[model samples]
Target: MTESLDDTALDRLFRTARTRNGWTDRPVAEALLRQVYDLAKMGPTSANVSPARFVFVASAAAKARLAPHLSNTNRPKALAAPVCAIVAFDLDFAQRIPELFPNNPGAQAWFADPKVAEVTAFRNGSLQGAYLMLAARALGLDCGPMSGFSQSGLDAEFFAGTSWRSNFLCSLGYGSDENLFPRNPRLAFEDACRVL
Candidate 1:
């Protein structure tokens, strides 16, 4: 892990990785999904508060459960993919502090306040979501992460009676080049960063 990655690996992970809008007929296996989660869970979080939870909607029935909550533009993208992951955060994540941060006996109490828990969960969970995408890419998978979905509807359909709340949705599979638009411009480092 200490070695620098080759150009090919870097391009696959970031440089040339596009936000897929379409997928091929190829399927993503369950074992590969487990590998993605195993790699992603290694990403660090505040106080080791690993709040993210994922639901890999791989079956047609499961996708059907998720489709109605997606925006019209996103519905087809998700339905066509081999798998759609519901990236979520658990509001009650602090309860696992004893296990995740064994050295900090009071770690759980640190997030005792509802507001603190909510913020920490959301921030760290979002980081985990990004890590998931990169992990998938590292394993030669394509990603199409989208925010165009009904949060409340998704939560009700998938997370009701649970502490989990949807953060975003990402479809995964072999991407198709069909309908791919030209690469968009990105802000230069000088414009997006600071030297302070």
Candidate 2:
């Protein structure tokens, strides 16, 4: 049986983790980015339809391309961070089911409908995005995840002619306390969950 994570690990991953609103000048390396993906990819998804695709905006030119797509409130956060990751979902994810779920040869047929494929891709991709954030935090990086951008604009700018569709953006780097707001309260377990 797997052992429970210690309190320190839990605190780092969830309890005390904050949504970074400001960033320092530290640069996130390519190797670290690869490591983050490697860990996040291990998270489970339905039928193993791993549809999430990440575009790391690390270079000045790429950040420039991303800036216009962000809202005014989010622009500075994205620009200030060392990397802004565009988390996307691939519409053609089902095509790879034969490779991803070899034991279930018929799994690919389940997503033949456009609607089913779209929903599965989006739902699983969002799960992967959350895994990505957790992995980043595990690697000692802070995250500022946002959905304030125009989806059509981001898709047009970053995913034209591709099956990938933008889901959200996450800025990654060392966080600064400059713009941090007081931590808000979460719903109690009884309020948000049930044993039945």
Candidate 3:
């Protein structure tokens, strides 16, 4: 019997989702990472271009390679986490747009221009990355998404010889409540939203 998600589950997964920094020594299994990716891929993208590419860094050597690229504030937490996902975008995403946007004629050409390619890749890739985080949370993992790293350094060390470019990095693991900051306030709907 399949049980429907209740409000408690929804609140835990969405309303209470926070950017966790501290982590326990527990490991994240490869199978769980695969499950997260599978769920995240179902999220929609513009033209279904699906520009995001993930490099899951789990091995000790891979983490070593990533260390020098991170800012001091992010390094310790990243090292303690069980895995780090290098979320990237392929510059040649247009090659797949024809298959993704079958009925839209000349859709692939929209990303042929360098500027257009950059915009599409970053925007869609970031959206996919967000889905990745939610999916991870649903799968009982905590995430620390950070952009305080050196993208160029990561590209040179990890993404060399590929069309993929580093967009951001996310540390994944079981979070420790000990280091968590108090939840901050959010703008009320009336203050932040505008009616059309």
Candidate 4:
């Protein structure tokens, strides 16, 4: 087994993560995408339900299919990015919860109700999506996460026959400094945190 690593690299990765708007006209290889998934899948989820699924739209035809689903504000950036990921959640995630949460009996039953399924799908999918962004950043890729797309349109166009449902869209590529928005001010740590 390999020795444990230090935390400095993780801290730097988080600190340096930026929401990129402009991208270089370079392709993100499938190998890199696989590596990103390998890292992201390690993140913890409720009962390890692991609902998030990704569809990497890199072909011209796929991009064309995705274009119509994006909002006017996001279309340009979406088209420019090397890869656009359709982040989704499987409706039947509970079926695999037993394997994911082997230590806990009846864990899968927690999401058996219709209302619980909806809640778990969105919540765990969102968490996994965030892990994806961090993983991409760690792999030296820039990300533009957007929610401006028409989710219903995406579902109809790309996920019509699948159990997967759209959660959000993320564009990944090599970013350019030319088109970045000015960094906005953030709440101070004290103001944003509360210790009980």
Candidate 5:
């Protein structure tokens, strides 16, 4: 049986972790980015559909391409961040099911309908994005995840002619604690969950 994570691990991953609003000048190395993805990819998804794609905007030219599409509030953070990742989803991810789930060749047929594909891609993709954030934090990086952006423009500029579409944006770097706001309260377990 698997053991529960210790207090320090829990705190590092959730209890005391804060969303980054700004970052220090420290850079996020490419190797670390690869490591982050390697860990996050292991997180489970329905039928292993694994639709999420990420674009690490580490260069000024790439960040410039993304800036105009972000909301005013997100623009400065995106610019200030060492890397702004575009967390996207593939609208045609089901095509890979035969490879990812070879034991169940019939699984690909489940998402043949556009509606089912949409829902499954979205649901699994969003989960992958969350896993990415957790993996980043575990690797000692910080994250600022945002959804206030022009999705169409991002998709048009960054994912043009590709099946990938924007889901959200995440800025990654070493956070400046001086830039953090007061921690917000979360719903109590009883208020947000149930044993039944």
Candidate 6:
């Protein structure tokens, strides 16, 4: 088994990570975004459905298209971010089960129920979004994940005819520490966890 990560690495990935509201002028290269996804896609998922997909908006026109869907508070931050990622999931993700979980030919049947598929897509897709953030963070990029946006509007604007639906949005870049909202309190271990 691999050794556990050191505290510094842990801090960088979790403890010290903040939801940034502002970013630097430095551009985030498209290649870096590809690298981050390469890291994130390695993380596990149920049935290996791997439902998460992303659209990195760096172009002015794309960002402008996305702006109207964002809340007033998030609009400015989205505009300032070097790259804004639209994390989405395919509604028919289970169809890829045969390719992703090859050994189990019946894997697709397991999620055949529409309701079950819906839950799995949203749950696992959201997990993949978390993985995406960690990968970006590990690559020296700061992440600001926010949900203050119109999912319907975004879906219509970006995924109108596609099976993909927006799960969440994360802004990526070298963030300005000056832009942080004071770190909020988190539940203590005893309050948030349980050990049987």
Q: Rate the local accuracy (lDDT) of all candidates.
A: 0.95, 0.94, 0.91, 0.89, 0.93, 0.93
Query: CA shift at 112, candidate 5, in angstroms?
Result: 0.6
Backbone Cα, N, C clashes tallied per candidate: 0, 0, 0, 0, 0, 0
Residue 45, model 6, lDDT: 90
In candidate 3 the C-alpha lDDT for residue 52 amounts to 99
Residues 61-177, model 6: lDDT tens digits: 999999999999899999899999999999899888888999996889988888888889899999999999999999999998999999999999999999899999999999997
Q: Cα deviation in Å at residue 96, candidate 2?
A: 0.8
lDDT of 3 by residue, 1-196 (tens): 5987898778768788788888888999999999999999999999899999999998999999999999999998888899999999999999987788889948998877899998999999999999999899998998999999998999999988989999999999899885799999999999999999
Where in model 4 is the C-alpha error above 4 Å? 1-12
- lDDT (Cα) of model 1: 0.95
For model 5, the superposed segments whose C-alpha errors exceed 4 Å read: none
Candidate topping lDDT: 1
lDDT of 5 by residue, 1-196 (tens): 5999999989989989898888899999999999999999999999899999999999999988998999998899888999999999998999999999899978999999998998899899999999999999999999999988999999999999998989999999998975689998889999999997
Q: Where does candidate 4 clash, by residue pair?
A: none
How would you encode candidate 4's per-residue C-alpha lDDT over 7-69 as one tens digit per residue? 766653665567888999988999999999999999998878899999999999999999999
Residue 133's lDDT in candidate 2: 98
Candidate 1 ranges with C-alpha deviation above 4 Å: 1-3
Q: What lDDT score goes with residue 37 in model 5?
A: 99
Structure candidate 1, residue pairs in collision: none
Q: After aligning candidate 2 to the native by TM-score, how far in Å is the CA of 66 from where it should be? A: 0.9
- State residue 115's C-alpha deviation in candidate 3, in Å: 0.6
RMSD of 5: 0.9
User: How many angstroms is residue 16 displaced in model 2 relative to the true structure, after the best TM-score fit?
Assistant: 1.4
Better of 2 and 4 by TM-score: 2
119 Cα displacement, candidate 6 (Å) = 0.5
